[model samples]
Target: MRIRTRGYERRRRELELLIVADIVTIFAWVLGFYGLHPNGHIDFLNPWLTIVVLVPLGAHVANRHLAADADAILLPLATLLNGLGYVMIGVLDPTQAHLQALWTLISVFAYVVCIFFVRNPDSLDRYRYLLAILGIGLLFSPMLPGIGENIGGERLWVHLGSLSFQPVEVSKLLLAIFLTSLLVEKRDLLARLRGGGLRRFGPIALTFGLALAIMAVEKDVGFALLIFVTFVLVMWIGTGNRIYLLFGAVTFVLGLVVGGAVLPQVHQRISVWLDPWKHAATTGYQLIQAQYAFGIGGLSGTGLGLSHPTVPVATSDFIFAAFGQELGLLGTSAIIISFLLLIGAGLRVALRAHGEFSSLLAMTMTIILALQTFFILAGVIRVLPLTGMTLPFLAYGGSSLLTNYILLAILMRISHRSNQFNDLREGTTG
Candidate 1:
């Protein structure tokens, strides 16, 4: 639906007030960094950073999802992103990696916030159409300007000057929406796919088979695994189908074997996972460093700015390592607990939503959040082979931060509406 003004003006005003609070937090952070580098100019104060702050606010004014149901959590999320960006900018400057994070922070933030701000969150029904466009786009995103295949053997990123955006980020959002739309539409039928009969066989099996085929061609086991897991979970959640769950497990194993055999890269990831120390000089360095950080951190961290983040790209793909190194295991555990809270909160919103589509949106988004957290954390802890995906809010990627922010915004909106719906039924709002 097109963005429009509803009764969200009050909510928007409230968000503005929250932004002020965020700016205050940022100011204190920047000042501390400046004090740390008194002789060195703190360039965190840049035109680019301003763009990050302003454009998303502008786009949100255009897109309109913000006001439908403002929640307190959204404020904190924005603050987290900006704060991390400040840290990345200050830390990486001495290292001399470009401020890609800052740029992405600006453009995508504007794009996503506008999407939620202009429209009533209650009106955001779903992004089926947008998701479709993104799906088609991802099919050829590797062909976009400045997009060259990365070292992981996937052409997932599209670069622009010093900044690179993961076009697949858009695809992830689209794919989740598409899956949620299907599950919600077919809930009753798929819900019946338990131990019923051959007629109840999982059609998702065939769809996943196709994904495995395509991803195999690209040799991207990680993407394949993520999409496959998403489908199975959404199906299970919607229908309560235990058989579908079992089938997914079996198929996942089959796919893993096939992937390992057909894709040398997949073999390498698993090999590295099995013994990262063997490949410590090559592919295993990140995980090795990650383990070291956690092992040394013990409970309370070494304290922020105190630990050595020897892992490459500590702010992005391995931000958790940064957390582990600086904040220690206790800090890392807090972050993990926060995600668990987000998952619980998102599921509660799904359960309470008034409509199936809205429920699907919440459930699908929650799955996205859970899987994203699982993906990177699993990689860091060596539960799964290393993949090049980023940690969600804490990671220093613009596209990821933007996508997650929008997801959180949508969830908060749904929760607020669901609560309001219950209140009306209970005659509280009136």
Candidate 2:
């Protein structure tokens, strides 16, 4: 009875912290929105703004009531990051904030669905092949006639009537599930250094290679690179094999070189990345503006909407730059720290998971989020060639936002189950 009481008290405290974090996030968004538009007073009656502020809190309450053992930090961290994204979007483009609010509601709904259905991550293994096929099909759907749309030189968007979204966003999560399931099942076989030859790893290699090839053809170098890096990480971690990692790195570099030589768009991006000033008037214009935004914002930010740095796609690809301009280096660092904390929580869940499949799933999802975040961050700062990937929670994209929420939901579910298992084991031993 005492142990149960302590457990209840701890959960109650966690719920309190989660609620406070959600409230703080809502306040930050409201304050930032008004700060950006000083002339426009806060409209407490604005239905969308009210929904934006309430949904996260409501989600937390629902999760606590439904999944009392869900990771307390995960949802709150995501909520704060997402709220910051909303504020940045509100500052850069008010229209996008409106759309983002709608997407947030939709994402919350998705999160609830995930929490309710995905009780056991291991059960997903049975449908790995089906999920893989569906994932690949979604990735390919953007190429279909009349439904396909190209934006920012990347043919990655699929339009159906009035609705348009990036199929790869959904595909990324599906593929993560498929890869986690497959890797767990064949860990030993794939990790073996001898025997079986090409037949053993050929199918896995072909699947990933075909996906990368399609992404390259679609001019989504960012997504291709992301997929490549994630596949390598998952393979390496799942199998504990360094040879596969080295081979993947070598193959990836070769692919980049060959693709750069063959594709004009790839060639252009590489050239711009190598010397942005040389092509400032043409391909490097955005990078130049981004650099200027960073320079203008030194240690502290320009303080929301004070400096209007005109970088193309500031709300999406170069959002970090826009954020750096408004919130400064310190603010940007805080955002990065939030992501690091989220990753840390995910790794903890992976480490604590009871089953191999659940462990691999949590680890793979964490790697995907971390890699995607690093890719976009490195690209924006010129640490690597810009591949135009959306920054996880901070970038302004409906599909990306929704996909991340689903990922968070799964992580929370896994964490809850792991905790339950640990508690049961303790009780048995006690």
Candidate 3:
């Protein structure tokens, strides 16, 4: 009964937070409209404008019926971030805002589908190898002739007639699932480096080779780094071995050296990172503009739509710069805090998961988010080379948004399953 009571409280708290988020989101939209059209009237009744509120409200209702005991904080936290992204994108480029809203609606449908159908998290483990193959194929699909696109110097998108999308966005989620299941099954073998020797080491070398191939062939340093870092971290966690950490560092350096020498893209990125001003008018223009945006943002932003971010790709890759220039330091700090909270909540779910596969899967998903966030933010500030990766839910990309929502749905399922197990145990004891 106590467990049931706590679950009810969690549901209530989630509803309350969602309400607060909706209210704030509408206010932000109003502010954006005023800034964009100083004298124009703001209309909150428009269906396009109200999608944010409706979507979350509908999801909350679905969760009550489908996953009542899931983590309360994840949905509200993600909603807040996504709402902020909507307002920022609307302000940055009103033309793109409607498309973003449409994508959000579609993503919510996908999220609901996953929550409704994926009742058993462990079932995914059964098809691990097949999923891994499909994921690898998707990851390299952008390299295919005719269909593959070379946009803005990166071969990361596929064009199908009039439709275009990045395959890596979907590939990442599948790869994470595969890695989780594989590590869980091989934990004992991987943990024993002494006897396993070359056999166990073979998997490590293959993973490293995959990362190198991505960097060398795909020429996407950001994603290659993301994949390698996630693999190393998840492996260490799965085996509880510090040796993996040492191996990871050495392999990372070797990859960098080989990449920098052989790949012009890698070398050029490093050059631009070291000194953007030298190529301010050409190669380093975006990074230079981003730095200026931060300077202009100071402590408190220029007040949303009031400040124009001239940085290229301000709506997607460098959206954080848009936030900094318009909302200032206070706004960016709030976003960072929210991500930290998300990481904490995800780790909590992993810790309390009912089985090893679920636990490892949860951890793998959390690491991907954490690393992706860090890489983009760090790159924006020039702490690392700028990578063309979107800022998760905050970036305006339909494929990315859809993939992230599916990830969220999976996490909710894991959380719900864990809670169900706890409730069963409580009943048995009583």
Candidate 4:
């Protein structure tokens, strides 16, 4: 009885937080719309507006019945970020807002489906090899002769009839699952590997090398770097070995040097990062404009949609710059803090997960989210070279939004199972 009451209480708290999120989200929407259309009245009949109000509420209600004891904060945090992102997309590019809204609907539907169906995430370990193969296939799918897309010099998209999407987005999720399952099974062997490090690491390296090679071929240096970092961190955690970490650092540095020397795309990015003014009118025009945007938005902001960011791809890869331009340092700080909180919540879930696989899966997903956020933000600020990647929930891309929502559902499921198991043990003891 006590456990059941506690579960209900947690759900109630989640509801309250979600309500707050919704209020903030709606305000942001109104503010953004107002900034864009100062004299116009909001169209209440818009389906996008309806979705903004209802989706999180609906997800919360579903969780009350389906996953009552899941972490109270994850959904609300996600909702706030997703909502803010949606508003920013509308402000930055009204044309894409409709498409983004449709994607959000589909993504949330997928999230609910995942909650209902994925009862045992650990069971996925049984098909680790198959998942690995599938991930590899997806990674290379864009490289296929006919369907491959060469958009803006990056061969990272695949066109299937009238539809096209980045397969790597889905591949990353599958690969993370495969890596977690493999690590759980091989942690001991990997930990004990002292002298035969090269031989032992060979298989893992080969698999990851293939992934990196494909990314290089596709000119996806950002994802290549992201996955490499994630793999190393997860491997270190799984095996409790610092050797892997050392190896990863050395290899990363070497790869950068070699890539810069050999790959024109990689070389150009590094060169621009080192000195954007050198090509300010041509190659570095986007970064230069982004820097100007930040400079214009000094303290508070120029006001939403008023900055009129001239940076290319301002709606996706450079969305942070757009936010920084309109909302200034304070707004960007709030975003950073939100991400930090989200990452901390994810880590907490991993720590309390019921099994090694669950913990690993949670950790892997969080790492991807954390690193991707860091990489993009750093790139935008010229801390690192720009990596033509979407800013998760904030970016106007169907594939990224869909993949992230699915991952969020899985995280919530793991949290639910973990807490429920704890309740059972306590009840038994009592």
| Per-residue C-alpha lDDT of model 4 across residues 1-430, encoded as one tens digit per residue | 4544667878999999988987887888888888878999988667886786678788888798888889999988888888888888888777788788888888888889989988888988888889899998998888899999988888889998988889989899998898888778877778875665566586457646864596578888888888888989988888888888988887888788888887888899999999999999888988998899899888888988676777799888888888888899999999999999988999988999999999999999999999998999999999999888778787888899889988899899999999888878887421
Better of 2 and 3 by lDDT: 3
C-alpha displacement of 148 in model 2, angstroms?
Answer: 0.8
- Model 1, 22-51: lDDT tens digits are 575356446545545556665656654555
lDDT string, candidate 3, 190-221, tens digits: 99867877666565677789888887778788
| Residue ranges of candidate 2 with Cα displaced over 4 Å | 1-14, 428-430
Judging by TM-score against the true structure, name the best candidate.
3
Worst 10 residues of 2 by lDDT: 1-10
Q: What stretches of model 1 exceed 4 Å from their correct place?
A: 1-68, 93-130, 143-148, 160-163, 193-203
By TM-score: ranked, best first: 3, 4, 2, 1
Q: What is the lDDT of residue 64 in candidate 2?
A: 70
Lowest summed lDDT across 10 adjacent residues in model 3 is found at 1-10
Best candidate according to lDDT: 3
Where does model 3 exceed 4 Å of error? Answer: 1-4, 427-430
lDDT for position 13 in model 2: 64
Worst 10 residues of 4 by lDDT: 203-212
